[model samples]
Target: MKRILCTTALTVGALIAALGLPAGAAQADSTPRIDLRVLVVSDGGPSTDAIAAELDTAGTPYTEIDLTAADRPVIDAELLADTVDGRPRAKYQAVVLPSDNPFAANSTEMAALVAYEQTYGIPQVDAYTYARPEAGLQYPDYSGSLDGVRAEVTDAGRAGPFGYLDGSVPFEDNSPSVGESYAYLAQPAAGADFTAYVDAAVPGTSQRGSLVGEYRHDGRRELVVTFVYNQYQQQFRLLARGIVEWMTGGVHLGASRNYFAVHVDDVFAADDRWNSELNCTPGDVDCPDGAGTPDPIRMVPDDVDHAVDWQEDHDFTLDMAYNGAGSVDHREDHNGVDHLTDKLVADRSRFRWINHTYTHAFLGCEQDTTVVPWRCATETDGSVRWVGRTAVVDEIATNRAWGESVGLPLENDELVTGEHSGLKVLPQQPDDNPNLAPALTDTGIAWLASDNSRDPRQRQVGPATTVPRYPMNVFYNAGRAAEQVDEYNWIYTSRAQGGSGICEDYPETSTCLAEPLDTATGYAEYIVPLETATALGHVLSNDPKPHFIHQSNLAEDRIAYPVLNGVLDGYDALFAANTPVVNLRMKAIGTELQRRAAWQGALRDGRVTAYRVGGTVTVEAPDGVAVTATMPTGTTLAGTAFGEAYAGERSGWTPSHGAPLTLALPSSAAQATGTAEPASATDPAPATRVPEGTREYTAAH
Candidate 1:
């Protein structure tokens, strides 16, 4: 029997009970259970006061298990699953490392955490973890201090966590700094409204403030730094709760493609910050200014550019799909898939090639046993297949082979998805191929592609029923929802397969693309037909759907989703013309004037509607009156909060209207199509029902 460790004595309820502030009505403990414990790998101040206050109010008990804490809470190596002795310490939920050493050093024993994660299922966060990425050093050039306005009342009765960082969150290299990070906080446990603690840059600083590292691992959140949290306390109280609630369960992969996942397959071919000079001219070497560096011009329809001719003209970043096959025609010179042991590069630009595989082996399929070389074996349809563990292991070994093929040497930091340079990317939905998942782990591939067999919905309905797949493929939606309701699309997957889609008969699923647009004249796949679906109530309101166009998938959509994206741009123009923007990038829409107003009016009347995930909560007040609120089911509040909408200036908006998917958009045609729709009632019935085998995947949507 597994033993349950007792709660840390530092918990808010225990703290509140110890405080003895009471009445005839005793306050219930509101601390939530899905524990979010933080372990400061590197010691020092990031100021946990703000976050702690918010968590306390929200009744979320988080233990600060400082690996470097002077008076650190007792933790066990066993607690950490470290071979070294330390038992009592394993009592918390997740372990958070704020600095470099904590993440890199103790993380030296990574297998321990892997075991712990496998056994206890605890997620560990490595926030702002150090180790010179460029120089491959242990720290940055030096340390920097973050400044902020001292609050009038420290722990203002608040709930949840939220904040912004105009100033830095001071920390030494490899040090764990605790600072306020949530956008708002509402201590529902106490009867107080909310608090806006972390807000605004002091009188002056520099350009825009930024967040260093923030991410969720294994469904557990590990905030590397708190650039912005509790900036506006009460007014945005609900938002604060929403942020923390989101953080608590790790980062929940949202329901749709808006949760874009960019592949950080190779180090930035440029400096850092996920940007690359791969777009730079051959010898010019005049690296584009970071700001001037276009937000990756994604060729919706990708194509291979043997040289810089087209890329230089369009200012597009060229992707050298490192292939062994191409090598057959080209040997050491030819560079396409045939052997995993060998592959090719794009001359000097080969530095930018994303290492998917030496040969594009869609890991889940089967290969011929009798064939001497795996590549020689093909399914009856001429599809390359692989089904053995040895081949999978060979696939894993290919990473090292590719690394050797290229010049990159692997390191520990390489494993952690490099704090994913982009925040809007959202969290990855678990893995689809469990075997692939292990291979990814074995080869340090945190991000892998899900073989979405052209459902277009990116859904996985059924092993028993319709069990949604994890880390479901987020298909690049080129345009707005208003434009793509019911469109018949010939999705481009493997160019070798002539971009299979609804019309084509696939070998595995048998079904083809059948995503319904819910149009008046039934469902259709034409652009005009699909765009017309929105008017028919399938998509109410003129507001565009929350669509995400990742830097990678943009290559595919450019080709297959030309019309959808082109038309969506038109809808974008229309929606922005309307003041209150309903759905868009949440961060971009958070304006200063609005942020100020929300900050000024904390715990507002009608403006704030409260909700949370766990049944528990913690609250505290100036009077020392603490109250805890508990609910059985989780929470949600419909309707908008920023009040009236703003049809901001739409002068610059220009819709990119083009011919539908039938016509190929240049560039993107080269990259494989990335998303797949779910099997539908509309698809022609298959000859064979999918055989029941072992199957499991989390519902990411």
Candidate 2:
């Protein structure tokens, strides 16, 4: 098997095979390791068989993109390119071929396959069938009638050796050879290794069925297992499995991550927030909410719309973190459910718990035109009031205490405030910001959601006018207001990203003036973004990305995200690749921060040097070019060597001390020299080119 070479944690290959993985080794519950993608290739055949064989042996799961699954082949080709969804197959450690025709039989089909491959950069196996009858073989095509066949140990050794046996084998489900097998004609390319071991051969035909070879595609490894029907006499399956494992980098992360939010505010008592199904509840005979109803699989549809309504739904509990004083018996208990403690015990995985408050408050102080309306705020003192510092701390404590009760540390719960009243939506000034850093620190909260796409040059918070609560698991207003009772039926219930007023379409509950789409579309996209983000988040965590909300979210009866779902549907196309399609969970972010912090700490300790170039930062841990790739390109990455690449374009800093106020870009660019390395302590250049350079400055390493 190909060995992984990295200085981080033990290479996964060595770790898993060495002594198996410790349960706690990869036990962190949040992470997705791959850059997942999917490609719906041709119908099944040998190429498909070869790919499936590798995936099965490696134990990697991928999404399948079958055009036949659609009534009409109208899927977006972009998402289908080496990806069923937005995730890329190449991102995975290993991937399987969707069909035998590795390349299209004609120019049109070839173009499609190439495009798909461009999107995904993982090793793929080709069964004898990938050779298109019409298109000449792109790789070495091997096919021959069975001739000389015999099993034997290898004698090719010339020096010290590992006890590797030599023999021909067959796969578990081997069928008659349907076509010819192909390999990259280049065989072993530069900076890559390839080998073709031959066990037996037929006259004037194919051999090396169980042989191993290596190739490279865009700096990634590709292992080729030539499958000539007569290549081996025995042990073909073993050889194939080994090759598959090697091709996929032989590493497996986690399975998947599902994201969703359950509202838990004042509207626990539902009125119209459900589907209007005609006689589906209450009455004994004709109106029974039974399991085998019309939509048997869908537990709760529009008709059975109730918070945590199981009449026709799955086992899901809506989140209930609000102003109930954490005690159901308290008069201030806006939520009847014992939200603090018992809620987690009832169902920890049922729904996502977003932080509203020990008590809730209206966000932004804006009046909802709908007479007596609902805002982010909740009832306290019998009326809505600003949930300032005390409320924030109380909310954090209550949520943390509840999570601890359920065996789920509040550490995993990223705090998200609901009453954007003005925070998540607008760029709150230090004076305007209701929850200042002092309050935030007091709450010990780790996460926060934004309401709008401000200057795009923001970190703590900036110009965004409103929260882009779309594609989100929770929306504050869904449980509020009596007129929009239909809100409960949908998983996503907020205005579009940066949409308009509480009632305006783009900016309102209708369309959310802040973003695209009307209420329905906004709501739908919101649902999609959650699953998508969760999946993406998992990847960031290097954990298994959860399968999207497959079966109508546990108890939340919201329909799934469609457009975004379709975009994500393709993620499954690379099941064989052991791809890590995950989301950017707070835990993963924290871990990454910890890693970088340690690395930076070492730099400060004179153990290494760090440099910030274009969109990437290079951490030279005494070794040259050890790790350097694109980082999260947000506004925060502007001043430090790690974040300077992203900051070069923003207008925040003014150059000083002979150091030109500019980005370290290519010499061809204006005011750039393509030589922007972090200056030594004695160097006169400034530490960073970020706006607040003085605040973010550091001594040269």
Candidate 3:
């Protein structure tokens, strides 16, 4: 029999007495059980979808009932709770509704949901509800645009669910001409049991009103949110964690952490410079003849020193994707000595290094660059001619051998092909080079880097699993701020705006710039912030994909710093020290993605089970499968403390060795407060008409 562990001992008689039960009525096995799952009832709205997205990112299992669907399951007591082997079982630990009430006031579904929450002490989230008496708030005293508003997390919020944040939640206002945020901010209703978690000062008034708060009435609790938002908004992303933690009482069947890592490609190589006259790099396909020999941008020894110092100052490490042949070529040209390579090798231990192949060769099909846009070379038989497997293997092996010779720290199993070649290139090389996978297998590579923009999903190339990387917009050939901005304008601006009109041609994926940017000031003022925001979004979304830039960005003007610093600084301002960014290596990130896939499959297949009964949480899964969980700080597993603390809770991944994994919750867990006060006998007033301008806000979502 599987044993259940509890931090404190309690006899059946004591439990019965505590419950005021008859002497023979209660048994040791009759403890109420709460399943570790969430129930989301969506009304095809962005707010509810945002919450659902958060749950998915955190790896939490939830059942979503689409109200718009004709065949949706009815919300009834039988579906919410049942008896399991003589134990009372609550099917879901928490509930999320589209609003305070999406159903008719006296509907049976609403009645059943209320009764279920009351009986199980489960919390409910009123996702994007109006701030009316029905939701424990007065009709909005101030309701309108809240763009650029800097809201505060009250003391109650800090002591409760929003402790991870550093007191402020600033709404994003990306454009001045457009309204990005709208909310109905209001005070609590008279005699209502309500407490605000987040609030902002009303414009033109000294009074503060709630945007997010808890409402309690009629023996039920609801976390009422008054603002409109979607999944991608920064304000929503910051508050998502607190919302879930509050609803789940800080215990859930999944985990999340903000992750960020950057890979600097072509570390030892020189990138051909962009030509302002030709509007392209001379060495690239688009340049005309007589565009002139390429003036390559290579980092000097001082640049290497600056990189090491910058890494130390920022408290971050960069993965240098080096090309060994670049250094060899430089030595042959410069009296058999390359000072930049010598300096980097001397300080090589300061940064992580990855194999970028020997000469950054294109491992894909043979290229026919005779045309304006290149295509794969074909034989007379019309079959694609490929770069042989031997060439690919030599490139990888030669790089590894050179790194070993120089004592550079390296992981032999990790490889990044030049330009993420060898894989499919649309309209050019439709399929992967047949020789590439075999070459990877020969090199014993287990993790290969691929471009996330081209192929976002991780797929197998021989024995290697591709690690998708985000390509930063910072151009590979740009070594100066002016050059970077010039290229950006050309790709994004319309032909009417003196650009190549690419953005106009592909309207969906690329938005045309209204006008050309001033190249001198654009890199610092616009590009840095835009790129930083994009990268930060990935970090906040629990994505572990590493962002990549060419080494040129780190040399010359060092334009990448402003963007990197902006991301770190923005994160620092939002999160407290308890929740720092998780920087991981490429291999570790790939492993994380693999584990998540397996764990999610187990959940979807119903092969894993988890539940909380009193102070004991039980988890069971197939042998060798790791289970991720977030629990109270002092919770323990196998008689030892469970996981590392983050955002006021302990969470991590642990393997289930074919036995039931039991967690003993701390005694303090029993004293944790609910999201709202205990239920009262009074009913709230019926909701009134929403404040003026509310319809416009609702429609925006």
Candidate 4:
């Protein structure tokens, strides 16, 4: 079992005695204590699971005490317990009550929980049932017959957590008698303040009552709602997140941020040869030398424009990795390149420009000095020799300059390597080009993209911070052969088809296929499902890296745009409409990671672990590094050592390096606040530089 080093409200002497530490020892090994964690009292219902999943996605620390089908004895004993691992179990700053019956008023478990809430003023969330005679528990005045009912937000609820709510929900389902019941039927006590109310057909009709309410008993506060926790419903999920944030006091954590991005690679001129073909026959006129290749595959102006328009329509931000040298065949004054850049620059709000490289320089290639074209140096190992540092700088500087000249203003210190093939160093001569670091650093490039499928060591070669991108979807390599096409289809289609041996012809016209058949060449497959799968993959893995695609995917006639649209649509259904899956650029994501990397747990001098337990976030940065904290709502700054409020959240002034920081909230605020730490006083740095040779690399768009 993993041991949790705990520091509770108990004194150090008491903790030492409990843990059998040396009596005279100065202190423990400075391993930071878990200041606080959210406690969940659940009955293992789907609703509880939904809430837990949200917390997990947010990276919130929580411990669940499963009481599913347990009697009062088991539930009461657990709640009454004072300590676990020599730390007070009651130290949980916030408690979640997903089940109405588990902690319903007057039950033995409920009594213990109520005592804890009253004493510590810990914020609690009560879903569905509250005080009720039907369940043999009664507190204030909660009374109602159990049923389904529709609700409307009251003027008061609009100012509370349910502010996003609008219209009668579950618009598809409605009760024959009650019209539409977006919520479960429940009644609020007399003292409870209603945020929402069940509406009657007429203004003063009978059936109208409280649907959502906040109850303050003595010093305890609980948000009571009648709706089930359904993650698929956007409103429910939004409300749940809002409720949690409100309870904690809107404390977004640096490490716990949900990260997202979408990078479109090879933002150059469209391939004129791209076409919708169906088959590759031996003697077919279109099949040149029987090699199944895309014909007339170039992206026309409409294709690029349509893609940009679609993304704009959805309000989706995209990262465009521009190759300054344009296509190899059309490098000298490519009108397509100019047109594409002009269009992209015109809609700067929807695109983040990235440096792909001046020429798509594969650093693995040792330039063939004798040849007029770029060529690789094939040494004895079948691998190209290392290109020197100067070559690296020229590639970066040239591309950035070109992008800026074209008004793209490519993000400085951020790059997506051409072909997603990052810098390579041969195994035999690992120490050959130590200059790659200084080269990238010199050009102000600090972030690089990598594929998750590659070996970690192979991907970690370059000096820049590596951002891992999903390697599931095809970027530009649409295979032009029978075998490659079948293999591609097998990966995505096989799951629904059971296996891929259903089609015999080059362009299999079978109904069992999951993708649409691309007639231009059977090799070109509609990868809408594949795109969706990639998005789902990143979400489940809890990796916030954006889903990546090549410029080919956006070609008007090809399968990429449709696939991308379908993927985004699926996200809307699963999450919320027009939600920014990841709104940050490559550089911003990199900086956030760096800030989080500086602190380990809540220890060290660089960054302190601030916990939002009561009113104030106790910042424990003894070696103060400008600790910033959100001021709790309904509270004002007190005259203490806590510094200025630069960006809304109270932040400490930059003191000399080793000064200690200890923030104390006003007594009233502490009594009323939840577990959310307040906002940061200092704004995040605009961009972060990887200090020389750090091996850290964040996944990019």
The candidate that wins on lDDT is: 3
Ranking, lDDT, top scorer first: 3, 4, 2, 1
Candidate 4 lDDT, tens digit per residue, 1-701?
A: 00011213545465344434455532422222223445666766556656556555444445566665343224432333233223332445567777444654567667666655554456676654544433222242223322332345555554444333443432223124653223434344444443332221212345455445555544556666554544443334434554555455444232222245678777763432322243232222223443555442344456656766777776777788877676433535554345554555576555778888877665544545443223456779876566677887788898888777767755688887665543443332333345567777788777877655442322334557766666545535442333334445553344455344445333444434646344345543344454555465454333555557666556644555555566566555443222235567876665544433333232222233334333434444435333333342233434444443322233223332443333455554543333234333221111111122111111220
Worst 10 residues of 3 by lDDT: 692-701
TM-score winner, 2 or 4:
4
User: What ordering of candidates by TM-score runs from best to worst?
Assistant: 3, 4, 2, 1
| Cα TM-score per model | 0.26, 0.34, 0.91, 0.60
In model 2, the runs with Cα more than 4 Å from the true position are 2-356, 363-387, 394-409, 412-414, 419-422, 426-434, 446-553, 556-585, 593-701
Residue 399 local lDDT, model 1: 45
- In order, the Cα lDDT scores of the candidates are 0.27, 0.32, 0.83, 0.48
- For model 1, the stretches where C-alpha displacement exceeds 4 angstroms are 1-354, 365-386, 407-441, 452-701
> Can you give the lDDT of residue 137 in candidate 1?
25
| Candidate 2 Cα deviation (angstroms), residue 598 | 9.0
Cand. 2 Cα-lDDT: 0.32
Residues 489-555, candidate 1: write the lDDT tens digits: 2232332433334244444543343343343433223443333322211111211212222333224
Clashes of each: 124, 114, 0, 32
